[model samples]
Target: MPFWRHPSPSLQPLSLLLLLGTLPLLCSAATPGQLPAKRIQPLPASNLGSGRVETKGPGLYELTAERRAALETIRYAEGTWKGGSSIGYRILYGGGTFNSFERHPDTVVVKRYASAAAGAYQFLPGTWEAATRSLGLSGFGPASQDQAALHLIERRGALAELDRGVLTDQAINRLAQEWASFPTASGGSAYGQPSKSVEQLRAFHRESLRRHQLRREGAPA
Candidate 1:
């Protein structure tokens, strides 16, 4: 079954609740003879927490340090960061790479579940189209994916809370509806699929914040 259906009330359609026992291995595996895509390197330690906000298309939003860390936490939960690389940007629904970022690689991969979800955020085609149109994003590259995910967070009304460095249970609960990987208040996958624990998410976010602070202070990450 498809991961999402169109004309849903939410910014993203509900995801397919498929058995994901092998999802981790699928996420890290590349297709035969397909070279891994170049990774989008992390910002230098000196650049973290420099108070420099990256403006998304037409300055629609600023990616502050807290917000960036929150996004990274989402990526972590989504199983998109393969071996510390941004190969997730080129990842298809189940696993495997797409050649171009000129647009969402709307290829539905059929494993235990079928989905056109792609990119680091696993945006379905409909979601990606909506985000790109809303944000004037022209590509499916790393910056565009980040901005798109932020837009979804904003749609869920959690952006302000995230910016305040308050990744509270309430905020996470609100975001859970958008990303299946995020646990709900009860610490289960909102979609009845695999998910990370709320405790794990909180811990990851805290460590990410600490690492950013360390970078800002010229300490080792």
Candidate 2:
């Protein structure tokens, strides 16, 4: 979909992971340093075919043309965070839309941004806005209205075992075509294979698990 298409109406410009004041989804106690296994369904950024994705998080690098064209297998990208444990919000661009990825353990959530979410997440940086208008490039509303959809089965619950294979043949085909046609550098709510995103997801999950253990042992946050 286009950037103007919003992902969610209720969510505001939440560029950081939100502690929505709800009880976290319950999960089994896992061994130290081990991620509690959960099903992961990926939304493709650029028509990349399905591949193994062991983690979840936003990607940082822009999807390049070569990366977009050569992504026959899922390519994951990496992300950076300021806080110690990476449970925060960030506005990462994907193929065509900007979506949200929540890592609340058993409550891992993916919400495709609606118009509101787009407005909430758009980068109306002071510099960019002035530059565009000076060059007669209209306004930022058009750029902020765009959004992406989530491929997750459960809107609130963690991914399931069977859901791991959620990436279908048709989805991959559609992604490939979308990448080829998509004009922007990034926007998405789905997972990429083997790209920098994949690594970030893995690291996020590992740290989340570590944090869980720390909480259990009463470590300082």
Top lDDT: which candidate number? Answer: 1
Q: What lDDT tens digits, residue by residue, belong to model 1 across residues 1-221?
A: 22233233222222333333222112211111122222222333222222342432243556666877898888888888774486877888667789987778778676665456788888877677666666666667787788768878877878889988767988888888788788778877666667888888899889887777677688998
lDDT of 2 by residue, 1-221 (tens): 12222242122232332333222211111011122323333323332222221224442112222122122122121221223222212333222233333111111233432121111122223222322332222222321111111111111122222134233333333332222111112433222222223234334434544554465478853
Which segments of model 1 are wrong by more than 4 Å? 1-59
Cα RMSDs of all predictions? 10.2, 20.6
Q: What's the residue-level lDDT of 8 in candidate 2?
A: 27
Q: Which candidate wins on TM-score?
A: 1
Kindly report the root-mean-square deviation of model 1 from the true structure over all alpha carbons. 10.2
Model 2, residue 6: displacement in angstroms?
18
lDDT at residue 107 of model 1 (Cα atoms): 82
The count of backbone overlaps in candidate 2 is: 42
